[model samples]
Structure formats: C-alpha cells, structure tokens
Target: TICGLFGFELDNFERAEVQKATRRLLEHEKRFLERGLRNFLIYKDMFLKSVYRAGLPEILIYLPIIESGCSPRARSRAGAVGLWQLMPSTAYDYHLRIDYWVDERKDPVKSTEAALKYLKRLFGYYGNWELALAAYNAGPANINRAIAMGKTRDYWILRKRGVLSRETSWYIPRFYAIVRIAENPAEFDLNIENAGKKFTFQVLELEKSLSIRELCRRAGIPYSEIRFLNPELRRAITPPGRRYNLKIPAGSLAPFLSAYHGIKKEYIEDVAVYTVRSGDTIGEIAERFGTSPSLIKLINGLRGSLIYAGQELVIPVKEGGLINKVPIRNNFRNYSSLISSSIRYTIRRGDTLWDIAKRYRIEMEVLLALNGIGYNEVLMPGNEILIPVNPLLSP
Candidate 1:
C-alpha cells in the first residue's frame, strides 16, 4: 500500500491503470531513452520514499518519467517545470522560489518534496488515486467541479467531457502503463539495473555567493556536474540574497568545505547586468532581459514610461551574477557592438536540455559546455543555469 505524506492509503484500481499506461509510454520512448539510467535509479529511491510517506499510489512514480523522463532541466510548453511539472505559481505556493538567480521548482529534490506534499493533500480530499491524479493534472477545483457535474467519480467519464486537454486525458493511461512496466520490466524488453544503489552526496552551507565555474574550479568537479547537481541556481553564480545548501559528492565535501573557508565570501562574483538602449521599448527591453515586458515593468519602477537613450535601467536577469574585475589582458578586447549577454533560465518540471538547446537554436554541445554538463546529465527544476548570447533566435 502506498502511503501519502499526510498518511493516507492508496489501494485503488486507479494505481494499476496508471502503471499500465506509463509502461506503454516508456516502451514507445525507448528510442529517445538513452543513458542517465544511473541517476534515474538513484532518484527512484527518493521518489519511492516520498511516495511511501505521502501514501500516494506507486503508480504515481511514473509521473516523473512522463513529465521529464527524470531530467532535472525539463520544461514544458505550459511553463510547468521539474520532475513533477509544477508551474511557477504552484511551486511558489509550496515554498519554491523563482527569482533572478534561482528557481527551486527545477531542483529534483525540492520539486519532489513539493509534488509529494501536493499529492498527499489531493489524496486527503478524495481518497481515490484516479481523482487525486486528475487533480494533479488539473487543479483540485477542476476535479471537484467535474465530480459535482458528472454525478460520477469515474475519471474516464470526466475525460470524455472534452474540457481536459488531450495530454491530460492520456496522462492517466500513461501513468498506469509506466507503473505496470516498472513492476515487472523483465517481462518487457526492459532490463533494469542499479535499483537499490545509493547516490552519495554531502551538504555545504553557503554564505557567500559563488558561480558554478568557481565551485567547479575549487571542487575539481566538472562544471557541468555542479550544474546538474544544483539546477536551482539560475545563474552560474549563487546570489547573496539567498543562502544555498549546496550538495557535493560525498567524499568531496570535506575538501570543498575546507577550500570554501579559505575563500572570502566577498570574493564571489556578481551577475552581470545590461543597460537599456536609447529608443528601446519594453518589448525590446523584455527581450534584452529574457523575460516578459510585464516582468520588466514590475522589476524596474516603470509605469510603462517611455524609455530614453542613455537610460541606465537595471536588467532583471537570472543565473551568474556580475563578473569579478579581471586585470585587463593586453591581448583581449571588446569589439562586438551587439547587445549580447547571458540569461539564466530556471529548470522547470518539463524541460529538457535538448528542448532548451532547440529553443535557443544553440548547438547541444555548446550549451552543455556553457553550463558545465555532460551529454547525459540531469536537468532538475529549481536549478539555475546560464544561457549565453543567441539573439538571432531570441523570441
């Protein structure tokens, strides 16, 4: 019996169905499924523990597989992010902050905690796996109204109302398929391994802000690995506004902590900011900020006022902060006149590196190198990463 965080029981046929659907989807995606199995296996333990505590159905485990294929940097078209595909509002309501420097909704551990907490509450209300699952897709209010209007508790009946998106309608079935396959993968062509292996990590309390590049330099870990481990850091640098509990590979923590103590907090870099140009409208400014005009207006004290030339407007950006002043090298010079800078995108529930690369029209390898990740690294939501200049593909 699956236990929800709030201590409820999930023993309904809904669990079985969701499992079956998830398995089918996994089979279908076998072509795209390659590598990262080790990380997925490690994450599975986290998933099971949370689900067991929440009294959620085991079938719900498959939700992440569909939502992000266990990728931490996964994002969705609807702006949902992370393994649980949480929207910014939902993540915020659950105490996941999305800011210029970090978005915790993409952090695998953080997102899983939020998602399990939400699932538990949904189960508390309905005591049915299918209904709770529906609520997970469409908010609880939507499911409650459907229950009241249809005069039935059947998920399929509500699914036929044509109100739910096609994805939502099929979502439940997919969940079931995955659960079914996970239960007995050997029966299928799937060969499961590393089911019980533990992922080793140690926590470091951060006081000063630092970039992943610097951390990588100190920890002797690949920059990409640090990015994968802390996707919630929207910038390559962590900001002073928030205290971060950085996780490092188990044995590396001692060395990292020792080196971190020697490094002064003030030595940490700040994220770079871009000033608005003359005749630049909010739309252009938004593009420059890599955010919407509304967000820009909200950030800067602008009442949609006309922007003037030489106005030094602070650009609201995410990811690494300003670069520390480096001694000018005689060979190096700034020649490009284009407005080029980096944007930090918080990994959300449904984001993938490939999707991110495609969205920015950047080569996959270049993006991976920029963020310090390998080809098969996980992109958890709530993690912050730097996006280098690619204005030609900017939207």
Candidate 2:
C-alpha cells in the first residue's frame, strides 16, 4: 500500500501490527496525536525544506513529531534533545555543537540537518526504511547484532524471529501508523489543516555578548517570544567573545535594529556561585537557576549526569533572573575553586538506602541515583557505597 508513497518502501503498510498501532493512536492517545500534529503543522514549511534539501523522503518530517511531538526543546531523561531527540554522542558524531552557551541539539535547523544526515546514514546501512527506523530507536549496534543472530536483513523477519528488542520491534509499526494517519487524516477523525499558521522567525547576527533579557527589552519583544524563537541558547546570555546568531520574531527586524543601536553595549553578566547541596540533582539545580542541566554540566565540566553535594557550580545568571524555587545557599566560590569530594561507606548488614540517606542528610533518591541502584535494590553487605562528603555541608 505504500507503493509510490515516498520514493521508498521497506515493508507492507497494511500489517495488523501497524493497524493496531494506528488504532492505539486514534482511540487511546488521540490527544497526544492531535497536539503533536498541531506542532508538526506549525513547523511544516521549515521541516519540508530541510527534508528536500537533504534529498530525503517527505514522510521523514513525521519522525520528529513521533520523537518529540515537534517540540524544539524536548529532551529525554537520557539526555537526547530537541525535535529530533538526538543523544549527545550521536549529536557529536553528526558535528552538532553541544557546549556551555549553546546546544545545537535544541536548534531546529541544526538538529534537523544532523538528524536527517543520521537517518540517511542509517538507511544506507540497512538499505531498508523499516530497519533504519528500528535502528534509530535502538542503536545500529543493537540492530547489527540482531541481524547477525537472526541471519536476516529483513526487519520483519528478524522481529518475527525474536532477535530484535521489544522496543525496536514495536517502533517501526508505530512509525508506519503515524505516517499512514498523516497521509489520510480524515480516516482517523483528525485534520492536519488545523495545525495553524506557519511559525515565522528572523535571524540576527551579533558580534558581542548580550543577555536575552536585555535584547527583549530593547527590541520591544516579549521574553517568552524570544525564548521560544531561540530555544538553543542554554543560558539567557549569548556565547561570550564570539560572533553569535540569534533568532527573533519574524518582521521585527526594523524595530530590533533601531533599538539595538540605541541600547548601550553590554558584556556577559557575572555568574552566581552555588554549592551543590545534599539531595541536589543537576536537573533540579538547573530548574532553580532558570538554566538547563546541559548548561550546568558544560559550566562545571561534568561529563556525567551525577552531581554530588559540596560540588561548586557557576550558575549563569542575568541580574536577578534566576527562578527562586529553592532557598539556595550561595557558596560564592569562583568557578576555579569548584571542587567535588566523596568518601566510600561499606554497606553493613541490615543497612538500608533510606537509613543511610537519612544519616547523610541527603534524599534516598539521590543515593540511588548516585550509585546507579534500582528502587528495590537489596543492599549487599561489604559492598562499598559512594557517599558524597563536602566540608561545607552540615553534619
């Protein structure tokens, strides 16, 4: 049924699995489908152009709809980001920049380009769209192992042989279902034309550092508008000491240029020092500081998701811009003075995570996250547990 659909056909489109997935979307998850389609239609033009320029299939644009609900800033807990939901490693592999001031994974244009390139590569590797879709959800390494184990190149055959992960086995069918519904929305009791007007924006190139708050003030634009237009900026401020490109609302160039020239030049604002507290997570700290976990990690030179108590972090802030959800204590240590120290505590018989967390004045979840333990973890005696010990932290 997908014949002459999108310049490629890797499987039968009318499979019962695909039909069940479609029914699941239309009957059980219609709200999400509607919302996701609304966002997809908003960026339809931009997404189409990207697909065309990359010489990819038109149906490819729907991938982001399924991946991120077409939200430019959507991120997974595993650190995949943007409309395409690219993991940091994959983003880096595609030459998408992920740094302190900006994460290109959140940039609509850059991330789309990177995602299309990745998809093309995967498609080329498998020579089948269904397999490529499966590989995208579960990495190619997993797919390769599945192929070798099953002695098959066909995705469905490998799926039938139970050589593919349950997630991957279901992924392609769900994708096919989305594509089918998108092709003929009327059959699904949905309408694509209702997605609304085009999302419009203009890019401005700047030579000096500037905070988004100041820019919005000068240009007479709403802070939320600017943030929506430029979701890739990790902080309110632009990259220091570099020529940066920022996006603003469409047709606001005249006012922005006039206002920009009149406003006094400014530099990056001073950073606020924060001492990581007991039970602190990078995500919680980022939410408190009006920044992102990616930004916090970049600033602190942290390579992983874990942050221990007593670690000093430099919070990127504009004047009084941080969200005050927490009564955060300021350690005031310079970024250069950032330090993290920890001690090992050997688990004793009858020791529990909750008891140990209470003794250390940290949360039980923090202990589990720190040690990568499961919620129902059974402590083994003599096993050493990593307990964060910061000198500045209260006993």
Candidate with best lDDT: 2
* Ten contiguous residues with the weakest lDDT in model 1: 330-339
Model 1 shows how many backbone clashes? 67
Angstrom error of the Cα, residue 259, model 1: value is 1.8
Give a tens-digit lDDT track for model 2, residues 282-375: 8888777766676565555567988778665766554455624333332221221111344567888899887787787764434543443433
Each model's TM-score, in the order given?
A: 0.62, 0.69
Model 2 TM-score?
0.69
Q: Write the per-residue lDDT of candidate 1 for residues 109-187, one digit (tens) a residue.
A: 8899898888778877887667788889878877777778777787777776655567767777765555455555666
Compute the lDDT for candidate 2: 0.72
Error of 1 at 361 (Å): 29
lDDT of 2 at 242: 56
How far is 179's C-alpha from truth in model 1 (Å)? 0.5
Give me the runs in candidate 1 sitting further than 4 Å from their true place. Answer: 1-27, 32-39, 55-59, 160-165, 191-199, 267-395
